[model samples]
Target: MPTQQSEPLPLGDTIQRYGLVSRILHWSMAALLLWQFLGMGLKLTLGRTPLVSFFTGSHQMVGTVLFVLILARVIWTIANRRHRPAHGDGLLGLAARAGHMALYLVMLIVPAAAILRAYGSERVFAPFGFQIFPAQQPEIGWMVGIGDALHGELGWLMLALIAGHVVMVGLHQAMWRDGTLQRMAGRPRG
Candidate 1:
């Protein structure tokens, strides 16, 4: 019987056009998203604590970061559309693309609506005295009500999107042994 000398996987050769900055931003955004969801959970259920406050404040900061980051992501995606994964004529792939587009829409809508709601609340959004949010007086405006309502509703929608995203990623990692999850990992496994 001969012992096998296995060849190493060609992972480096499988690299995406996504650069270091893009990869870093992608992972950081994913992690921060978990933290932000935890913060929202605390706000909804656990009530305020030092930890909750920390997470909420951090979530807001991260959300602000995300608002800008998503714009960058959009520009990058548009500029480098050719580098994207092969979304062939497969139905599953088409569905995946549709899911991606929905997620992107939610990404833009949720944070922006939250930001606007915060502005409507008339809270002093002075991120270093720079009026980080629009300064409108906190009145019982219908627009505020609608904004807040959709903002809250979008939370649940976002949860669904995130859950689906995770499930799909896990499915690819577990069943297909694909790089979906591995690429997002800090140090991709061999």
Candidate 2:
């Protein structure tokens, strides 16, 4: 018999739901990104203190790790492209696809720009205390300029996109009752 709408999805990517890898990547990135924002938000609001210092200190390292995770996610996504659940039909689906594409683009660019800036900076940046790039004698103007201009601005924009993503998930769960959340959380539909 054909699977019912209420059936729990498979362990791997299926027409009805995401696989374990996808769900793991999705939620892990969500948590790490939340930490990044939370730390920054506290720094901005509460000003510098020992607690804030702790968070800000880890920010660069965590951001670097996030960049690596994003790369892994992209690779996994490409490998699973054909087997993954469909976004659905019509305008909502198109919007979902566009939103996801935007998320990916921003995710890739945010840390990349920062890393570029780090590479070109006059002061050495050693994330996790491992010197990835030695300090330059003179800062590269264009690299620093790109990072200075886009890093914070695009970071905020990415945050907005993340907010929209959460709202959309809530909509799927509440308004549509589509079991969309189950694709990433819970046990699946039934």
Candidate 3:
């Protein structure tokens, strides 16, 4: 009798579903983005309460981490573009593609703006107790201005986009009975 060997799990995406690396990046970013939104929402509703303070205190660091993750995700996405599931052919598919592009654009922009502001601010940009950007003596007005203008506004916009994304996923599951969520969240297809 011959011994049989099981195949290894995929690290990159396949036509059927996202692989381990893509799933990890997707879920991890989802969690971090949720934290960011929750903190900001609390700050808006409750002002300076201890709970809000706790969330806000870690905001910069979390944002920095998100920035890095988004960069990695972009790279990974480009690498796996040819192997991933298709968006389908139709207006719906076009919308899906457009929606995802918008999400990626805002995701990249939100943190990048904040980082630019931090780099140009009078105070040092220290996250996790280490300085990545030193304080500017005079402060760069344009950098700070662009960041201040875009960060909060675009953040809210991104939240709205995220809500739409979730609603669409629900629609796919409920109306179409499609395994759209499974592409990213479900167990690997055998």
Candidate 4:
């Protein structure tokens, strides 16, 4: 009789759970988003103190990085859509799906609005000492207006959604006793 050999773990997602790439993207974005929120929260609470400045000093660069990561995550998600875990059935599942979609929407929009604001500003949009968007000659009022209107408002909205998401996950763990978090945080299923 031949001996059985185990298969190698996949880097992409599988039906049972998220794989290395998906987990990396998910956790990375989570951590970065937390940083952004913390910085902004401190700014709001503490005014322009050095402590707030310390966190916010890299805000633009971090936001730019987050935008790129969001794009990559979206592409990766689409590619892995068939293989990843399902949201499950019935009302809760539908709500989960809708909530996730909204989260993605706001994630894309928040940085996008800021980028638009940066593009329309008289100041050059440079992060990490490199220029990305050049300053508008007369400053595009419409672009600036849209960005100004949406960026902060939608950001706070995103934060609220994130809090809700975490609460739901906690419910899953405590009440449902489901391994929902394991989909992203646990080791890949064999």
Tens-digit lDDT string for candidate 3 (9-85): 59999988888898899999999999999999999999999999999889999999999999999999999999998
Please tell me which predicted candidate would have the highest TM-score against the true structure.
Answer: 3
Q: Could you tell me which residue pairs clash in candidate 2? A: none
Give lDDT tens digits, candidate 4, residues 67-110: 99999999999999999889889999999999999999999999
- Sort by lDDT, top down from the best: 3, 4, 2, 1
What are the TM-scores, per candidate, against the unseen true structure?
0.79, 0.92, 0.94, 0.93
**For candidate 3, what is the lDDT?**
0.92
**RMSDs, each prediction?**
4.8, 3.5, 3.0, 3.1
Tens digit per residue, CA lDDT, model 2, 14-41: 7667887888788889988999998889
* lDDT, residue 93, model 3: 96
Q: Give the C-alpha miss distance for residue 18 in model 1, angstroms.
A: 3.8
Q: In candidate 2, where is summed lDDT lowest over 10 consecutive residues? A: 3-12
Candidate 4 yields a Cα-based lDDT of: 0.91
Q: Which runs of model 3 end up more than 4 angstroms from their true locations?
A: 1-8, 188-190
Against the correct fold, how does model 2 do in TM-score? 0.92
Candidate 1, residue 187: Cα displacement in angstroms equals: 8.7
